[model samples]
Target: MTALFDVILPVFLVVGFGYLVCWRKWLTEVAVDGVMRFAQNFALPVLLFSAIARLDLGANYNPLLLLAFYCGAILSFLLGVALARYWLKRPIEDAIAIGFVCLFSNSLLLGVPITERAYGAEALVGNFTIISIHSPLLYTFGITAMEFARAQGQNLPLGRVALRALSGVLHTPLVIGILCGFAMNLMGLAGLVMPDGFWAAVTMMSSAALPAALFGLGGILYRYRPEGEMRAIALCCFGSLLLHPAVTFGLGKLFALSIAEMRSAVVTAAMPPGVNAYLFAALYGVAKRVSASAVLVATGLSILTVWFWLGALP
Candidate 1:
């Protein structure tokens, strides 16, 4: 109850507020899109850049932790694809979009803040470690898979398909921001090159990333009805809320990860599908309904699911 009220409810309150405002017609769809655009293209990217720039890669980049967490993520993706393709009778492209939804957890907006609230700021190093490469790695994998799925049966050369996919991934603002952060970190130019004022301004913008995105997500979600994808949405919710974290928890135990690492990995894995899931679906024009409904339903379900996981965790 404490976790439900203290940790999860506060987050949903913001989402609910957005939904209420949109329901009352106070915020138009275009306005919501503008907010999302600001968050996705600018503020969130700045947040990622700042987080990765100052990330202590040497101390927190635990290979075992990453291995445990990502193994679960990949398994969920594969399961989502398989179940959607075989059981749900969705097309290959739709299956891939569903898989992407299951694969891409809300690591940033939900995971980081939830972990911070549940544990503490001091415990966020593991969350940060996972997040540092979360977008880049998952986006790459999802895009590559999607491209390959789209390329099936076409005479398009494999190299061209690969290049096209690569181009799409590279052109994303989030990916660009992550790459820039990595370059800065690797080249040791974080503090040395950028002026303090620049960093401060980044700090200011980055702070709005989560709240604004969450609010925008609520409004955007209002546009997507669950409709005919009940089974698919249930599968997505199951994979994201239960299967992913179960795999992560088992792997973490096998790896003997510390309490903090286990907490971070499982909690992150338990988050609902992010807005990117719907964005990916919308971008590819496949399974948009399922993706969006899953985002909405899973996010609502996560209010309870995350509370359970928090109790189940050490």
Candidate 2:
């Protein structure tokens, strides 16, 4: 327990600091955006690239582990669509966004740092696998589905939709990092260490990603309030915090993954919706408020839910 606290406390403390500063209005939107943009476009990719470059892929990597969490993702997408359309009575566009909120997790910002703390850098082999493909699988599916729905009433080209979805995956920074890392791994650059000065710079940039992301979370969260159709928002939160992880755990059991692998799968699935979902909603003008509200709600509640998982997991 004490050991767990030692790991969990620092992570949330950074998150708390970000929230506090935002609440106090010390970090303005411009500053927050700058920090977040830099982290996403540069800092996070470097962090991921470095982490992946160093990974001893032979013994640590497990391709099968992705099945557990992605099983949850698939179900969440279908559930989001069904609930939004039937239960919530929202438009197909809104339903697609709702499904997206349920599908995407805050894997990059929260998952990476927390998992590093709880499971060490080695455990990240499985963690990175999910992170690498998380956006592509979920976003591509969501985007293509939404586009297809639009096509039902019009003559949108299938080729164009496929290209757009492929573009989304290609432009993602985490995916870029994962590709670069894999390249390094294949090129036998994993063991190659940079000189002290350059290494220091890489390490500094990598370390900056977590705090910047948390601070960005704190600042961005204030933009959302519990407005609009909140029942749908509540559903999104429920799926994110509970159903997502629960489904993953069941799948892990089915796959007969190691206890540690099971723990990682569950914990990663348990993360709240990433801001990217809200960004996606806003970009396409589909359930923007619902997506933002879901991110805020799930993130606020996750402080407790994440703690419980950390303590519960062996």
Global Cα RMSD, each model: 1.6, 2.4
Q: What 10-residue stretch in candidate 1 is worst by lDDT? A: 186-195
**Each model's C-alpha lDDT?**
0.88, 0.81
For all predicted structures, in order, the TM-scores are 0.95, 0.91
Whole-model lDDT for model 1 versus the true structure?
0.88
Native-to-model Cα distance after best TM-score fit, residue 305 in candidate 2, in Å: 1.7
Report the C-alpha lDDT of model 1 over 1-314, residue by residue, as the tens digit: 88988888888888888788888999888898999899889988888888787777787899999999899999999999999999999999999999988999999888977898899878888887888778778887888898888888887888887787788878888878887877778767434577789889998998899899888878877777776579999989999999999999999999999999999999999999998998999999999889999998999899989999999999
The candidate that wins on TM-score is: 1
Tens digit of per-residue lDDT, candidate 2, span 35-90: 88888888888888877766677765676678789889878878988999999999
- Give model 2's TM-score versus the native structure: 0.91
